[model samples]
Target: MHPLRSATAAPSRRALACALSLALFPFVAAATDGMSDARTLDRVVVIGTPTQPLTFVTDTKLPRQPVPASDGADYLKTIPGFTALRNGGTNGDPVLRGMFGSRLNLLSNDGSMPGACPARMDNPLSYVAPETYDTLVVVKGPQTVLWGPGASAGTVRFQRETPRFDAPGLRVQGSLLGGSFVRNDQLLDATAGNATGYARLTANRSESGDYRDGHGDRVPTAWKKWNTDLALGWTPDADTLVEVSAGIGDGQARYAGRGMDGAQFKRESLGLRFEKAFHGALRKVQASLYRNDADHVMDNYTLRDPNPMGPMPMPMASNVDRTTDGGRIAAEWGWGDVVLTTGIDAQRSRHRTRNAMGRDAYKTVAWSPDATLRNTGVFAEGTWTLDAGRRWVAGLRSDRARATDQRATRSAMGMGGMAMPNPTLGLTRSETLPAGFVRFEHDIAGSGFGWYAGVGHTARMPDYWELISPNMGPMGTVNAFAGVRPEKTTQLDIGGQYRGKRMDAWVSAYAGRIDDFILFRYPTGGMMGATSMASNVDARIHGAEAGVDLRLAADWSVGGSLAWAWGANTTAGTPLPQMTPLEGRLTAGWDNGHWSAGALLRVVARQDRVAVGQGNVVGRDLGPSAGFATLALNAGYRLSERLQLAAGMDNLFDRAYAEHLNLAGSADFGYPAMPVRINEPGRNLWLKLNFTL
Candidate 1:
C-alpha cells in the first residue's frame, strides 16, 4: 500500500491543442530575432553555479542536463545543496541542506502558494513550472529577512520580469521539446504594447508516460500539466509602475511511492502591485497583494487496480484544497553611504477536505474545514558602506503566528480502525517568533575576490504537515498539535567567491543548533498500515557546498561542484535520518560561434548512517543505500538569429540507482511491502527547439 500510483485526464484536450496552435502561428511566421545584442548558443547547464555569496541567480529559460524537468523540484536538482525525494516524474518535494517541508520558504511573484495534501503529494514546488518564469533566485540559509518567516533552511523565489516597450510592438519567445517515454512540451511567452501600457502572456503544456528503469522495469511515473498566465502593466514614467496579474493551471501526476495517484491538480491566482521611485533620500516604495487557490484530488482507482490482498482493497478518493492570501509593503531610504529597507507583511491560509469510497464520489461529500493558519511580520534591514571595498549588513524581524484546529474526530493509528474524539479540537495556538542576522563583506581592495560571514537566528512554528499529518504526538500527549513545540534555530554562515579573467570559484559552509527540532517517526503494523508520529528533539547540522569554473580557452570551459551534509540528534545520540549523502558533479562544455556541446558526470557516495523509521512526513530512512554515478551529453546548434536546436542523452550507461531521500515503492506497484526505494529513470534521449521573435 505504498499510498496507490497513476493519473487521469479530462475533456477538452482538442481545445487545448487548438488554442496552442493559434497562439503559436504568428510567432513562428514572424521568426525575426528581437534581442538587443547578438548571441551565441550556450551549452546546456549541468549544474548552476552560485552568482554571489549565499545567493544563486540563474536564467530559467536555459536548457539543463538530465533533460528538462516537468516540475520545479526536478529543475532544482541542477543546483548544488539541493535534492528531491523521488516520487515520480513530477511533483517531488525539494530538500535543501537536508531540510524539508516549510523550513524552506517557497514563493512565486513574492506570494506563498501552499498545497493541501496532508502527506504533501502536492508540495509548494509542485505548482511551479520553472520555464514560465524569467528568473530563479535562491538565498541559502537564514541569511536574510526580506521575505516572510520560517526560512530556517532558506528562501526560493521564481520571478517574471516586467514587460516594457518604448514603441508599439510584439515580442515572443517559445520552445518545443520531445523526449523518451512519449514526453512532449510546448511553451509560449508573448507580449504586446507601447510605453503607456503592455499586455503579456505566458503558457506551457507538458506530458509523459511511464518510463523504464535501468533494469527495464516500468515505474509508475506518468503525468500531464499545463498553465496560463497574463499580466497587464503601466509604466507611466521612469520611476513609476503598476501591474495586474492572473493565472490558472491544472495537472495530474502518478507516483510510484504513493498509494494514491493525483487525479486532479487545479490552481487559480490573482495579484496586484505598485512601485514608485523618488530622486533623493526617499528612494522607493513597493507594495503588492496576492491570492492563490490549490485544489487537488487523489484516488486509487484512476490509475491502478486495487489489489484485493493489499491494504487498500476498495476504490477510494480524497479531495483537498487550500486558499492562501497575503500582502506586503516596503520602502527604501538612502542617506549618504548608508541605506535602509523596512517592510510589513501578512498572510492567511485555510484548508478543507472531503472523501468518499467510490469513483469520483468525493464530489458529493460536504467539505470539512480542518485548519486555519495566520502570520503577520515586520522587518527592517540596513546596509552601511564603510569604504569602497567593505560593507556591513544587518536585519531584524518578528512574526506573530497562529493556528486553529477545526477537526471533530481523528483517525486512530491502527487502534482497531476506530475514530477517536479530537482532544485539541477548536483549540488555537499562538506564538511570537523573532529572527535576525548580520554579516560583513569585503572585496579586498582591487582584487576580484570577496568574502562574507554571518550569524542568524529564527524561531519557526510547526507547519501544517508536521502538526496535522502525523497520526500521533509525543508520549502522554493527545496529538501533534497539542504536544509539538515551535523550533528555534541559531546558525553561522561563512562563504567567499572569486571572479577572475579566466576562472570563477565559490564556497559556502554552515553549522546550526536546533532547539526542539521537529522529527517524524513511521511505525509499521497499524490497522491502516504505516502511521506517522511527531515529536521534538535537540539536533545539530553542518554542511558545505563549493564549486569552481575555469576557462581552458575562449570557447571551452570546465567546472565541478561538491555538496555534503551531516547531522546528529543530541537527544538520542544518533545520526540524523534522511540526510543527503556526499555528492559531486563534473562538467566540460565548449561553445564555438554557432555550435555548442557539453558533458556532465555526477557521483554520489554511499550513505551508511541510519535511523530507519524516522524522517519527515513523506517518508523515513529505508536503511543504508549504495551510491552510484551517472553521465549525460548535450549538443546545440544555432539555426539562425531566431531559432536554435538542442539535444541530450541522460544516464548514458543506463545505470540503475535511487536517491537516499526517496519514498518506498508502493506494494500496489509490485514492490515488496518492506519499503524499497523507487529507481530513477534509465538512459533517455531528448531534443528541444527554441525560438525568439
Candidate 2:
C-alpha cells in the first residue's frame, strides 16, 4: 500500500478485525427482526427535505438527536458529495463540487451573513450554531431557485419555525455533553403558545481543547462560542400568521494556519414573515423579510497565547470589520396543479480597517471605509404539472451589483513586479448578470420510484472581499481581484430515487462547463516575497453519487454511499486542483426497543492527476494528495420517554491519516516538525445526554 493508504491493520491482524466486526451481526439481526413491518415502512429519518433530490431536511421541532456537528460547515459534510477544506480542528470551509463562498448561498432565517476578513476568518457559517435553529436545509447544486441568485453550487438555509396553538401549551428540550480533550456543550430550546400568539427562545454554548492526532501528537486548534435567538408570533386565525424574530452570536478561536486569530465575532439579525392560505383558487401565499449584521475583530493579541518564535515575534495588530444589511421578499402562489413563485432582494455592505504594530498602537488609527458594495435583484420561477405523472419547472433571474475600492495607496510591496497604487489606478466595477434554469420530473412507479433531469445557467459577479484582500504570505503583496470578470456556468443534472419496504436507494450525476472560472494562483516571482493572485480560467467538471439503505431484518439495517468527481482546466489541459477523490461509506446498525448500536467504514481513493497550481478562490493547492480509509463506531440508549444517551468513537482503529484538502499547521503548533498534514484524531470519545419536556 502507498504510505498514505496503508491499511490500519497488518495482514496478520486483518482476520481478527474481520471476525470481531462479524461477531456482533447476529445480535443486531435478531433485534431488528422484532420490529413490525408497518412501523418500519412508516418511519422517516432525514437530514434534509424534498425541494430537490439532493436536498435533506433537519426538523428542530422534533427532539434533537446527537450528530457529530462541531461547526456549521462540519455539519454539512454529512451530506454526500460534500467536503471541507480542513483549516484546523474546526472551521473547515465547506465546498460542493469544488465551489466555495458566494458560489453557495448560505442564509439564517432568510438573512444574509457575509464575512469581512480578507482571508475569511469569520466565515459565514463560523458564527452559526445548528443546535440553536429549528431547521437546517440544504439543496445541492443549482437545482432550485427558491433562495437567491448566483447559487451555482447550492443553497443552505437555517430556519426557525413559528409555533401555533388552539389552546395553551409549552415545550422545552435541552442537551449537555462532556467528552475527551476538555470538550463540553450545552443547548436549550423552549417555546410557549396560546390560541392567539406564540413565543420561542434558543441558546447554545460549545468549547473544546487542543486534540491529539492519530499518532498521539498534539494539534493546537481549539475554540468556544455562544448564541441565542428569540421569536414572537401572531396567529389570529388558521389561515394567517406573522412573526418577528431576532438573534445574536459571538465567539473566538485559535487557528493553526494563519497569522492572526479570531478574537471577537459579533452578530445581530432581525426578521419578519407573513403567511396565509386561501380557500379558493390560490392555495397559499408566503412572504418574509430579514436583516443581518456581522461585526468581526481579529488581531495577534488576546485571542491566542503569543509565541515568540511565531511569525509576528512582536504583538502586531490589525482589524477589519464590516456590516452586511440585506432583506428578501418572496411569495409562493398555487393554482390548480401549477405553482408560481417570485421574489426581489437587495443588500448593501461596507468595510473599514485599522492597523498598528504595537499592542495598543492601532487604537489611534482612525477607522475609515475600506470598501463599499451593493446588490439588487429579482427572480421568478414556475412549476407546471403537464400530466398526472409528469411535471416541469422553469426559472429566470437578473441582478445588478456595484463595488468600489477606496485606498490611499497600495503597500510599497509589489506582486510579480506589478507596483502598488497600480499605474492602472484603483478599481470600480458594475455588473449586470442574467441566470435561468429548466427541469423535468416524472413518477416511474407510482408506489415510490421517480426520476428527474435539469439544466441550469448562472452568471455570477465577483464578491467584494475577494476583490481587495491581501496576498497573505511572506510576499506582503495584495491580490487585485477587482479587474476579474464575472463567471458564467452551464450545467446538466440527472437523478432518480426508489423507495420500498426493505430497501431505499438514490443516484445522481452532473456535468458542467464554466467560462472565465475564477482561479486563485500563487506566484513564485513575488515583487517582495511569495504572493497569490486570483484570475479567470476556463474549466469543466463531472461527477456522480449514489446511496442505498437496506433492511436485513426487522431490527437490523445496512447502508452505503459512494461519490466520485473529476475536473480539468481546458485552458491548461490539466486536472483541476483540490478535486475530491472517489470515496465510499458503509454503515451497519441495530436498534432494539431501548438500545441502538452502529459502526461505519469510510474508504478514499488516491488522486494522482492534478493541475499543479489552481485552487479555491482563497486557498492554495497542494498537488496530488494520497488517500486512506478509516472506521467509526457508535451506540445510543433511551432511558425513558424524555431522556436519552449516545456515545461514539471515531477513527476506532486509531489510524494515522490526513485529508487531501488540508492546510499546514502554524508555528505555535510546532508546524514543520509535526507536518504530516495534521493527522485526524486517533480515537475520539463523546457522550451526549438529551432531555425533552
Candidate 3:
C-alpha cells in the first residue's frame, strides 16, 4: 500500500470508538505515578489574546478551545478582519479585510507554496498544518514592505523557531483529538539535541466522515490528510547557525460547493537557511532558499458516483501541478536609535496540466506546460527614533515580474469543443512594479497610549490566474493578458492602541484608491455553463476594525471586536462584489488555577450591496445573504504538569447559517438546481489531549 494512503486511511471503527477509553488508561497510569510529586500544576488557557491594530502574533502550539483547527484558514478566521470563503468543512480560502488572492502573501517558514489548481482547489493554506508550526504572524495591510511585493491586503507567516541546547537533551510534544462525525486527529513533534547540533521531526494526521448540518442533512465535507517533516541544524556558536529541512504530505477532500472533489493533494518541499551575527555596522545577516511542489488531482468519480444528468455525465479527471523555487538574503544594521534592513529576493514557478476522460487516465497522458512566472525584487526599510516617545519608519521596493504563455490552443468551453487560436501563444509579458510606505508613531508620555499613521503605494503585476484563466477578454482584446493592466493602489492608514490597568483596546482605519483594478464579469447561462471576462476599472475601498479586552476580575475577563469593510466600483457605478459584512464577536471567559471556561457569541450583519456576477478568482456574490448569529462554549482542565485536556461545543444552538462570501452548493451535493448558499455545520463536540515531556 502507498505510504500516503496508509498514513491517512481510517482505523477500524472499533479502535476509534475505544480511543477515549485507551487514552484514559494512560492518564490514570501517569496520575498514579505522579501522585507523590509536589509540583504545582500549570493552568490551561483556552482563548488567545485579541489582535491589535497592525500586527497579530500567537503561539500556534497552544491548544485552542473551540476545537483545534484542521488547516491554516480555519485558525486565521479567529483573528480580527479575517474571514474564510467556505466551501465545506475544511480547506477554505482565507480573505483579509475584503481582499483575496495573491494580495495576501502567505508563507511557511519564509517559503512560498503556490497551489496547482487554476480554480484554487488546493490553496496555500490547505497544505499548512498550523499546529505543526511554532508561531503564526500576521501583518495587516500594506503598512510594511519587507516580506514581498503586491501585498495590498497583508502577509501571513507560519514559522518554526530554532531550538538552542546548552547540554545534551531530548524534548517531545504531542496531541490527540476525537470528535463527532468520526473526526480523529493526532500530532507529534520531537527534538533531540546537544550543544553543537539538533534533529527535529513533526508529523500529523486528520480524518473525518460526512457531517450533518442543523437540519440533519448530510454535507459532503469528508476529508483525510497526513504530513511529516524533518529538520537538522548545526550551531557552531550561540550567534551563528545553519539548518536544512525537508517535508512531504498528501490529502483528499470532498467539496459540497463544486462539481468535482479533490482526489489528491500531494506536496514536497526542501529548504536551507543560514544566520550570523556580527559586531560591526552590519549587525546581522540572514539567507534562505526553498523549493515547493504541489500536485493536485480533481475528479467526478473518485469520491462520489458521477451524476448522469448533471453537467459532467461520465468519469473524468484533471491533474495539475506547480513547482516553485525562491530565496531571500538580507542584512541588518543598527547605530544608536537608527536601524536599517536591506534584502533582495527572487522566485520562479511553472504550471502544467493534463486531463482525460477515464478514471486515472490523466496520469498516462503527457503533461503540457501552461504558464511560467518569474519575479526578482530588492527592498530597503529603515526606522529612526526621533525621541524616547516618537519614531519614524519608511521603506521602498522594486520588482521585475515576467509571465510566459505556453499554450498552443485556448480552452474550448464557450467555443463548443473547437480549439481556438491562443492569442498569447509563445508570448511573454513583463512589468516593473514599485512599492513604498512611510509611517510615524507616537507614544503618549505616561498615558499608556500609542498612535500611528502611515501612507503606502503599491503597483502589482497581474497574477497567473487573473491573466490566463478567464474565458473571455476585455472589450477590445482577444484574451485577458493583452488587455489587463497592472493594478496600482495608494492608501492611508491610521490607528491607536491603549493599554490600561484593567483594559486594553485598539482601533485601525484605512482608505485607499485603486487604478486599473482587475475585475471579473460572469455572463449568465453560457454554453460552457459559466464564462468569465476580465476587465480593468477604477475603485475605492475603506474599512475599520476595533477590539477591546477587559478584565472583570482576577479570574474573569470579557472581550469584543468589530470589523467593517466597504468598497465601490467607481467606473462601473456599483458596489464591489464579495465584500465582507459588518461583523462582531463577544467573548467571556473564567480561568482558575487548573480549570478554564469560555463562551463566544458571533454576530454578522446582512450584506445587501453586492455585484451579483462579479468577484475575484475564488468566488462571487451569491445574491445578498441574510444575517445570523452563533454561539460556542469551551472548557479545559489540567490533569498534570505534563498533561492537559480540553473540550468544546461549536454552534451551541445548532442554528442554520451561511457566510456571505460563499460558493453555491453544487447539484451533485443534493443542492437545488438553482445556485444557493451552502449551509454551515451544525452543533458539534470535540475533545483534545495535550502532553509534553
* TM-score of candidate 1 to 2 decimals: 0.95
Candidate 2 Cα misplacement greater than 4 A, ranges: 1-52, 60-67, 280-283, 303-310, 412-419, 422-427, 470-481, 524-530, 673-676
User: Which 10-residue window of candidate 2 scores lowest in summed lDDT?
Assistant: 37-46
Give lDDT: candidate 3, residue 61: 67
Candidate 1: C-alpha RMSD to true structure equals 3.7
Error of 3 at 197 (Å): 1.0
**Alpha-carbon runs more than 4 Å astray in model 3:** 1-53, 412-417, 525-529
Q: Tell me, what's the RMSD of every candidate?
A: 3.7, 7.7, 3.1
The candidate with the higher lDDT, 2 or 3, is 3
lDDT of all predictions: 0.86, 0.70, 0.84
**Considering lDDT, where higher is better, how would the candidates rank from best to worst?**
1, 3, 2
Please write out the lDDT profile of model 1 over residues 441-483, one tens digit for every residue: 8763458788999999999999998778778989889999999
Q: Give one digit per residue, the lDDT tens place, for model 3 in 1-693.
A: 423234224535623663565368346636433533233433233333435447788877666745688999888887778999888878999998888888889999999997998788799999999989988999888877888889888889999999889999887777888887777888999999999999999999988777778887878888899999999999989999899999999999988888888989999999999999999889999999999999999998888778887877888899999999999999999998999999999999999999988889898999999999999999999999999989999999999999998988886453224578897898999999999999998875578898999998988888888887787778988898778999998989999988898998888899999899888887533211267788999999999988888999999989888999999999989998878999998989888867888888889999999998788777887688999998989887776766777778888999888899888888876787666887888888877777776
TM-scores vs. true structure, each candidate: 0.95, 0.88, 0.95
Q: Would you list the clashing residue pairs of candidate 3?
A: none
Q: Please give the clash total of every predicted structure, in order.
A: 7, 11, 0
301, model 2: CA deviation in Å?
3.5
